[model samples]
Each structure stands twice: as structure tokens, then as C-alpha cells.
Target chain A: MKRRTFLITTTAALAAASIPVARYYSNGKKNYPPLIMPEELGNFCEEKVIREIGDQYRKQVPQESEKAKLQQILLTDDAGKLTAVSDNAAIAALLDKKIQDDFNSSRILVLSGWVISVTEARQCALFSLT
Target chain B: MHIDARQLDNQSVIEGDICIIGAGAAGISMALDLENSAHKVILLEGGGMEYDDRVQELYNGKLTGHPYYPMKASRLHYFGGSTGHWGGMCSTFDEIDFEKRDWVENSGWPITLKDISPFYPKAHEILDLGAFEWGAEYWVKQNNALKLLPLDDNIIWSKMWHFSPPTRFGTKYKDAVVNAKNIHLYTYANVVDIVATDNVASIKQVTIKNYAGKEHTVKAKKFVLACCSIQTSRLLLASNKQAPHGLGNDNDLVGRYFMEHAELKTGEMWLNHTEPLSFYLMGDKTKVRAELAISPQKQKELGILNATVSLMPLAMSKNTIPSIKIWSQDDPRKALDTFHKYSNLDKRNYIQKLFSKGFYQSYGLYTRSEQLPNPDSRVVLSEEKDELGVPRANLHWALSPIDKKTVYTINKVLGQQIGAARLGRVKLYDFLLNDDPQLPDYTSGGWHHMGTTRMHEDPKKGVVDANCRIHGIDNLYVAGSSCYTTGGAVNPTLTLVAISLRLSDHLKKTM
Candidate 1:
């Protein structure tokens, strides 16, 4: 199946469950919920793993400002987000790129003693909120 | 023939064509190489066939710079020397290890790996290793189960290592050495002082003493010090009657440039999926294994020293203690016991269950790396002397910024590689995350001492020449790791024996 078709099917399947969303303004003009949702990450990892990674992320990057900066980097279309995503597949592809970019650019964190990209940490943080 | 030096009468003079001081791996290899040759070879060992408390005490010394293993327990003083306890991991040095790396200060050897390549087969035989093959592809081709990690070949490569049935030279080669017509093995014949001519141009004879109070002189046309790196330098620095500084100390480089393989657990690798990394596993049945090594180009590009990374199942590795901590007992026997106790902890059934269940796909990344030769990291003659009246060695194992940086960079690059491959993520230890150059308290060495009497063509830069002969001294040579210009990432035994055989060949030609 095509990636757009897969994302639309996933969104339809996950529509029964409520996902808490946070709003952020891009270019100080438009407001949208996070492109990648915490519920969306369930397709990749377990809830326990996400929570454990979230705890580690908070410990290593303790400052709220630093966490906010990383979250912004993940959510914003300006810096590391390489594409305009209309669905979960595009967001997943973008997340993969950001993770690779984080590694290539040395923007990595020791999450639960496993070196992981910032985008993965942000998704875990988003999962911890629910 | 084997003779106990203590049985000799006081002031006895023994003569030989070549006198090799120390019956460790190097001395024995050299003696075995000269077996049945036309020239007489005297192989002198300070300790006897068994471990002696009083004799082992001679290795006791002070550590002033870094936290290290108890000097007394770090090296064995008996017949086989430290090889009695050696784990018997062996590999040949890379071409880069002998090159004059511009980024590493005081790097490079007078002779390249090619110069010593011919002798490695003989070294492999001496160590009882497999067919002298050290490439990953060769071993991989032999075993279908040996699966290598798919990493960028240009950035990282697999370096192969073979395990020795760990041939204990004392037991395995004792008969060969004692039976050889031209090789005379002397036990408890500790060399005390080397007498030189008035000008200190050449070695005339050496004095050997034993606890039995028997003092004797051994005169030979040539002498080789194979008493390990520290003791070799100690003997040179202590022989100060003719040359007030020491024998071959005109340039004062006799006891300098000490180095060790900086070994430590640097990181953890969490695989994305469960994969049997059979190629890297080391077990009783394992004949050969591969360790991940940074390519020469990668090391040069990053300005880091040569290093290799080994993987261990995290389940057992997390419970393991650093060797420097376990090997701290003053008695080598006690230290060995402690080391064995801790090493056996991983063999429990619960650890085996963890592996069988495939619950955790994580591995501990361990580094065995080269240390840049720092002159300050050296051995000096201590004012305090041992029971033999010869001064004990004082080790100051100082490490430079490059040492810690090389380790940190290795883990970091490996992390990058894992991410690129999507294999897994690599989490560096907290100690490596900082920008500080100092090594962590857990940092340890492989107990493979080297580079005290480094080899170089120029007398100003090294104590020995390219041929392992002490510069400016016609007949004195160092036939061990003391002549090593740099200690590569692999264990030093294979290279030390290969070079010793090379030195033996040189002696055969000149004598």
C-alpha cells in the first residue's frame, strides 16, 4: 500500500482513542497540533519503552528550556523537518530523517543508557503526557 | 641444560656467546630460536619454575601518577613471566601502528609491520595460535555462522584475533629449552648490575645474584635484556657505576616513553532486533573472534589514536568489575584468584538463561586502544631497593588528552555508525559525555607493559636502534616489548615474540 493510504488507514483505526494534543505557532501566524502524535508512536514501540525513554530524556536534558528547544526542533517545519506532512507516514518518514540528521549532526542524547535521536525522545515525551 | 644459579659458588664466572637476561616469553623464544645453534645461549630467569613470594616481591614499586594495578602483582616474576596468567589473545599489528602518525606525538617505529611480518608465523606457532591468519574474511569464510555487522567498511573494519591454548612457556617449552645443547637455562639468577668499559661504550659483563647469597659474573660477547619493559628499564637505569646516569643513558631515554593499552568499557550497543553476533563471541570453544576497529583513514581523519571495540553481552558485562580493581592484591597469586572469581561470575545459569531467552539485545562496548607515547609516563629507579640490593622501579603512568579523546571518539563514531545502519543505538557512558580530557576512575590498562626502551634509528629519540641494539653500545640489545616504539590496540605478546625472533635472527647473523 502507498504511504499516504497507510497513514489514512492508521488514523482511521486510531480515531476511536483520544490523543491529547499541544498547539504551536509556526512563523507566528498559523497554529496547528503537533504533526507527530504520541499515539502515532505506538506503531513503532511499546508504551513501557516510551515511558522509560521519556524518564531518561528528562534526566539527561533536565532543563525545561532545553526540552522545549528539542520539542520545537521536532515539531517545527523550519529546522530539521524536511517536508510538509499531511499524514502519519510523511511524519514518520520525516522523523526518520530527523533521527539520522541528529546523529550526523551530533545532536543525540543518552536515553535510558541508549544513545537515541532527539526526535525519538520528543515522541517519548509526548507519550508520557498521556 | 638447566642449572640453578643459586647452586653456583660465590664469584663464579659463567661464559656464553650470548647472555639473555630474563626467561620470560621473549627470552625463552629467543633461546628456543637459537636452539642447537653453534653459539651458546644463557637464559637467566630471576624466579624459578614455580611462583616464589620473595622473588615476586622484586616487582613491587610505587605508582605516583595514575591509579594502576599493584606493581608487585601486575607482572609475574617466575619462569614463564607474566604469560603464566596471560589470557592468550593475539593479533598482528596494523601498518598504521608502525607509521609516523603526524597527529600522535612520538609515534612510529623504526621498522614497519612488513619488516616483522615474516616472523609472525613462528610467533603464532610459539603462542599455539591458529594458522597465522588475522583477517576477518578468512575466518568468516571458514565458518558460516560468523556473521559480521553491516557497517561502512571505509569507516570501520573487523580485526581478527586468535586465542592461544595459551601455551604456558614454563611448562610447554621447558623441556625444549633445557634439552637444547646450546641453550642453558638458569633459574634464580637475577641480574643485578651490568659492568661497562671505562668509556661506557660496550657491555663487558653482568653480575647475577641470588637470595642464597651466591654472587657471580657472566661474560658474553653479546647481551639481550628480555626482562619485560619495566624491569628492563630498571636494570638499565640502575647500572650507574660507569655511566653515572645509567647504561645507554647518554640521551637519558632509557626509562621513558612508557605506554599501555588503554582499556575500558566505553558504551552500550542496543540492537534494534535480536541477531546472533556469533563472530564476536569468545568462549572456550572459540578459536578466533573479531573486534570492531576504526579504519586507518578514519583514525587519521579524526586525529585519534588506533583503537578497537569489543562487544560483550550486557547481562554479564554489567556485573563485571574492572581488572585494575580486581588485580590489586600485593600477591600475584591472590590477585589471580580474585580475578578468576570475578571472571567466573558471568557463567551462572541465570546469565545463560538471559542469552537463551533473547530477552535483551544489548551489548557492552569495550575498548582496547593504543596510548600515545608520553615521556612523562615512565619508569625511574626508586631510592628504595628490593631484597637483591637493586633499586625497584617507580612507575608514573601519565596519560595525555589524546588518550581519553581517542576513547571518547571511538564510542561516538560507533554510535554514529549504528544510527546510520539502523541496527541500534549506542549509548556512551556518563564518563565519556563530558568534554574533560582526564580519564575516569574506571579506566584501566591491559597489563601489557611496553615502550620503556623504545626503538628508533636516532640515539637522541630512542634507547635502542632499529636492530633492537642499544644505541652507541655495540653488543647490548633489548629483546622484548621495551623495544616497542608504540603499543598497538592488540595484546603485545604476538608482536613481542615476533620481534624477539627477528632479534634472534639478527644475533645469528652478527655472532
Candidate 2:
């Protein structure tokens, strides 16, 4: 997408959201998407992760400080199909696949004209990796 | 699967204008720069695209100096080089980073920061971070709008930052590299030796062998070694065919001056702050998303040197679920629709909020300024050669006692200021003193590695020049954090990318 078009579309779509809309180019008056952040692999990476993770559990709850059970989940998918799994990779794979399929369905309609949904599953397609 | 030179029956010999050893960051960047240029570039990798178990095993060893992601942290054997899994946090070295600090030893770069400044933009554009431009002074947005707030230090401590698409070189740049016309980046051809002239000054050819027992000899007009620090120095130490000590170790400077970011376990918090920080958004780089330190007042008050902050989020920070906030429907931020996307919003705020209310971490680690350089902390050559005749690197990472003292002092002073401002409470762990049976917090390890083949203007003190060229060798070069004279408190990826682009232009002129 052209830079101008992307900004326009993103702004128009998100203009109705509850959050405050940011201006992309201050003087230029282009609107930016809102920032509604959660936990991201990239975020922990910026802060010394081990320190951050340890800090979240260790400092806040002195009672359970002795035992902090932090779990990391990593999942990989090839062409919308799961491929590999790990303890900590990225959160996209950790979130509900139903949501991913929902987002992707909208994405297909938005960009390439393809219609695929989570319910369009075939018994033969769900085979485990050999 | 190690190959012997005698099996060269079906092997190929190639000649080129540039022969790059250790196909890592600088090597691939050079090849990309010279993709269609006149320079005949040949990149040799000890580890190849087809994963070799042995090489992978060696790379899995503890990342002694720097902290990269755990699962993704593999000293890559693939085409894109170690950049395959790199988290693209790009920044350039400052002039102060080049100057020898009284606090640091075996320190100082041969080149000035100006030499690498020009290349930062191209790297930034390539990385896709237009919103957060590098080197450009911070800007503020007047009509700002976003779900997240600035990293107000009153609410959050270490704030968040950003980079472009955060390039994972291997995956992002792989297509252009594999199809390049002028660049021949052979995957498994690991260079064993830099066949130099009898005088031992000029590198003539490199002998390489792959896991399939195949041998290849490559010669070029210019050569570059851009492997990670330990390997670059190790390759020098192992190429003892001409120089008994190693390739560039006449003064034993090849593997010396290893630097990594050492982290301190700042004491934990019992209560998570109710409010989140906005400093990470305050910078002009991205949206005015958050704010932390680095303002004029704070810089002077804390004698603030260069550093970057990133606020981390906790599980409670993500409790934007409609179910959790069902009781508080009137809450301003209780929109269920926005809850899921909160992770994609300004993460720095989430961290500040999480720490404010219920969640907090025990350790607040500061990847402090480049610890004083010490020659004793060096990368040595291992007697054993891998599947490729390339010798392995044995990392002997030891730090100066003063390094620990600095961390302690930073914690004490910074913590006091934080508490004085009522930002957060501070705890100084007794890990450095006798073992603390109660609190086992400690200062240890570097996730960011740097300064092996350092950049220097003078040949006597450094290996590479301001342009990142080997002083003695005409066409040879080095790049990445390994070329950093000092590892600043911030991440090194941006600096490496910036310098690499600058070096590419330098090579362009010479080519």
C-alpha cells in the first residue's frame, strides 16, 4: 500500500475506536493508530528480559517471591498451519487461533480476495508433523 | 561429517575481488552492498544453511557477553548469517563511545562516530522504522492521540523504545541475497585458514571444506572477517599457518577486549504501581507514546550518560478482558474491544501500570555502560576444528572488580533518586559481598557482545579504521558490535547496521 493510503485507511478505520487518535505527522495532520499495548516479545526484549520477568514476580509479591511460576509458550505455523512449538517464541501463536483466523479472514477480504475460516477444516488437513 | 582436503577431487576453486570469511553480519552486509557492483565477493561460512548439529552445539554455549533471545539465539550457520535471528535494535556509537574513558581499560575505537553517522539512515529505512528515525533529535506531537500514555516516570521506571520492522536479517533479506548476481554466498563452505603470504601480512587465499567432505579454495582481492566477536578473533588465532601466534595477533590484540552488557538485579517491588509510565512514548522517534528520563533536567541532575529504557509488562497489565472488568463497566479504559489489542499498544505503559498495582519484579537490571575493557577477558582459539577446518573459539570472560562497584554505585544513587521522587523503592542485594543466603540477586552476564576487532584511526591501538577497514590489509574490513570500541548502555544492533551501511559506501568508492 502507498504510505498516504495506509495512513488514511488506518485512521478512518480506527477513528471510531474509544482511544485517543494520534496524529502521524504533527504538522502534516495525518492521524496515527492508537496504542493499546499488552505483552509482546519485542517489549521484554528491550528491557533486560530476565531482569524484567524476575522483577515482576520477585518484587511485587514477597510471599510468593520464593516460588514464581512463569510459563512461556512458543508455537509456529506454516501457511496457517502449526509447525513447531517452544517454551517462548512469540505471543501470536500463544493467543487463541480462533481470533487469528477471525483476523485473517478480515485480512483476506481487505487485501487478497481469499475466503478461509477456522470452521472450514478438513479431517485430512489436521495431521501431525512426521 | 568433517571433510579433508585430500577429497578435493570434485571440489571447485573460485577467485574474486573480495573474499569474506565467517558469513555473519558485516560479511553479508558487504555482499549486499556489493551485490551488483564490480567487486567479486565470495562469502564463506563455517556453518552452512543445512544445519550441522556440531556447529549448532557450539553456538548454543552460554551467550557470555550479550543477551539475545534464548530459542532464537543460535550462532547462525545460515545464509543471512547471525542476523538471521537478530532483534533489530539499531543505534550508532557516539563520539564519547570512541574516546578512551578513564573508567574503561583496553578501550577506545580507532574511528570517530562521524565516520559511521551517515550510514544510519539507510539502515533505518531498510529496517522500516520511519516513525522512529535514528539520530534525529526527539520531537513531540501536539495533536497526539493513542490508547497508551507517555512513560511518565512517576508511574513507570525503565521505559520502552523501538526500531524499524526490527529486521531479522536471515528471514527478511534472504531472498535478495540468494538471487544476487555478483555475490556468491555459498552456505556450507566454512573457511579453515586465511592462506596468507610467507611474510604473514597479506592474506592470499582461504582453504574451506564442508560437512560433505568437499573442499574449495577461494581467493579474492580484499577479505573481511565479520563473524561474531569470539569467532572473528578465533579465526585469527586459528589461522596460524603464516603467523605462529595468529593472523592479526602479533600484539595479541585479536581476541582481547571482549565487552558485554552486564545487568544488575535491582531490588523488587511489593506493590505494582496503579499508574503506568509514558516515557517510551515521549520520544519523537515513534508517536509521543511514553516518557522516561533523558530530559534536560534529568540528564544534568543524574549526570545521565547515554542509555535506553524499556518498560516491561506483567500478566495483570493484560487484565483488560471484559470478564475481569465486568464489575467496573464505568471504568474509562474498560472497553473489551481494546483489551485484546492492548499488547499491540504502547507496552511501556502496561509495564508501568502492572508494577504500580499488584505486580512487580525483584530485579531491575541495568545493562550498564561498557564495563572497563580488560585484555584478560579475551576469546582464545580452541585446539579443535569443527566440520570445517575453521578453529573454534574458547571464550574466557572475566570482568574487573570496579565493574561491579559501578553497578552498585549506579543502583545506590539512582535508587535514591527514584525513591526521593517517590517513583519506587530500592533494594541493594548483597550478591557482591559474601553470598546472600536471603537475597540471591547478582550482577552478571552480557546479552550484547562487542569490541573484538575494534575500529581505530591509528594502526597501533586498533584493528580497523574509522571506515571500519583493517589498517594493514587494504581491502579487508570488519563490522557489527565486534567493531564497537565501547558497548554503550543501549543495544548495539542499530549501531552495527549504521556502520555497516557507511562501510558499504566506503567499499563502493574503492570498488
The number of the candidate with the highest TM-score is: 1
Clash counts per candidate, in order, are 0, 64
Candidate 1 has which clashing residue pairs, if any? none
TM-score for each candidate, following the candidate numbering = 0.87, 0.63
Question: Over the stretch B275-366, how does candidate 1's per-residue lDDT look in tens digits?
Answer: 76879866557788999999999999999999999886665456556767756787878865554443423233343443443324667788
Supply candidate 2's per-residue lDDT for B304: 30
Residue B483, candidate 1: Cα error in Å is: 1.1
DockQ for every model comes to: 0.11, 0.01
Best by DockQ: 1
lDDT of 1 at B274: 63
| CAPRI-style class, candidate 1 | incorrect
**Any runs in candidate 1 off by more than 4 Å, and if so which?**
A1-86, A97-130, B339-350
Lowest summed lDDT across 10 adjacent residues in model 1 chain B is found at B342-351
